[model samples]
Target: MEADLPHLVAFMLGTGVRIGEALAVHWHEVDLEAGTVEITHTIARVRGEGLIRKVTKSRAGERLLHLPNWALAVLRARHAAGILNDPVFADTRGGYRDPSNTRRALRTALSPVGNTARRDLGLSLRTLRRETGMTRKQVANHLNWPQNRVELVETGRIKVDHELVRTLVATYNVDLEQFHGLLAQIHDAVQPAESDKLAWIRSHALRKTTATALDQAGHTARQIADQLGQAKVSITQDIYMGRQSANPAAAQALEHAFDDPDLL
Candidate 1:
């Protein structure tokens, strides 16, 4: 993950910025001396419009944010060698990084983190999809499944069954050897021991973790919401900060409250 993504994921976690917002940030927007970054633009893919840079989702999202020291250091080093007009995080061609490309990069980077079998299978499927220039919907249509089903399988949310494997093999025109290799990976990933490590890790988990940490550290919900560019504190509280238990004993308390000798 470190080698493939470099500092991109870390930058997003440290700042609690959305992936699009982080990708759209330019070197000129970073103030190393002030330890601040101006949140101005975000990258979005509009239907029939392609990738476009637009103002943030809301007025609150346009506010400037103070950077953490580590985030500041990253920008400082980049500023020392990077061009002002270029994106802080650039594509291979040294232009704005597309959010889709970033997601693909993340999937590749995380391929080795846990459950090697699942990761390998997911990466292989994703690679074939990209090579064929087929969208998830296109693949789903070919396989007679919903787009989310194709997405879930590729993201490791759904297990790769034999039927899906055969469909993918036929859809992508994989040879006999490749089919066998994929089958082997699917079999390995479904082993009881490997199942425990098969959890899917989404990129948004970083943002949620950051928000939860801030909430635990006594930052106001509104403050965290602002930093995350959320239009409402309720949104941040309900979504990001809700991932963890605010009080660990709440579960025990509920158990005790519902305790009944007859039921037991």
Candidate 2:
């Protein structure tokens, strides 16, 4: 029971559904055909009681979301194991899950995997979701939310979009699918390719040579500098690098100057 809490919480994390939303999720809210979940209400702790139904945090909070394949698998698996109906995560008494108990269960569940915070701490699971690159707004959009609601969710002070969440995951080269498959590949395949590196350097050299030739062709150093937006010393360094090539046109143009008084 305790060992399964993180797996339960992982569903919320993967989907970016709020804890309250996850707690309140019932069979009626899901549409297997459409692959979506309708956000209606949530279960929250108001007083000293266990779980109570409450209105969603915002009007934007009440929206529909397309369920990802990964999320659906977890949901389907849990449902198939007799976790359907009134409360998706019911306690042993067959009532709503207690928030305190849920926290303890989560702590216990995360321990075997070595992937949770201190049990006695004040950290909200939402913060943990963000740290783990999961959050409500992010999950909602992946499920195809209303345009107006999606806007509010992304830029809203309270929630962030799924794309933003994906962006965060991308920074770590993580993919939610199969968890760390893509991450492992990126880590393993990220060595610098010497051939590609040399190709890029050669391209830079050609560009430098072209720029210098054009610059030496009666163009002022400042004009060339303005064109490339580089320092004059940089131009000098390119010339020093032996990138200057003899052009027949430039030599022809210079040949006339060698015999003319105006060249002086």
Per-prediction RMSD in angstroms? 11.4, 28.4
Candidate 2 global CA lDDT score: 0.46
lDDT of 2 by residue, 1-264 (tens): 533553454345333455566667677887766656666677787767646977776543565655445555667777778766577666666667665556544433222211111111112223434676745566456555533332222222122234544554443345645445433433322333322232222213333543455455675443333322232346565455332111223322223323333311
TM-score of 2: 0.39
Clashes of each: 0, 2
RMSD versus native structure for model 2: 28.4
Note the residue pairs that clash in candidate 1: none
TM-score of each: 0.62, 0.39
Q: List candidate 2 segments past 4 Å from native.
A: 48-50, 112-264
Clashes of 2: 2
Q: What range of 10 consecutive residues in model 2 has the weakest lDDT sum?
A: 113-122
Error of 1 at 24 (Å): 1.2
Give lDDT: candidate 2, residue 233.
Answer: 42
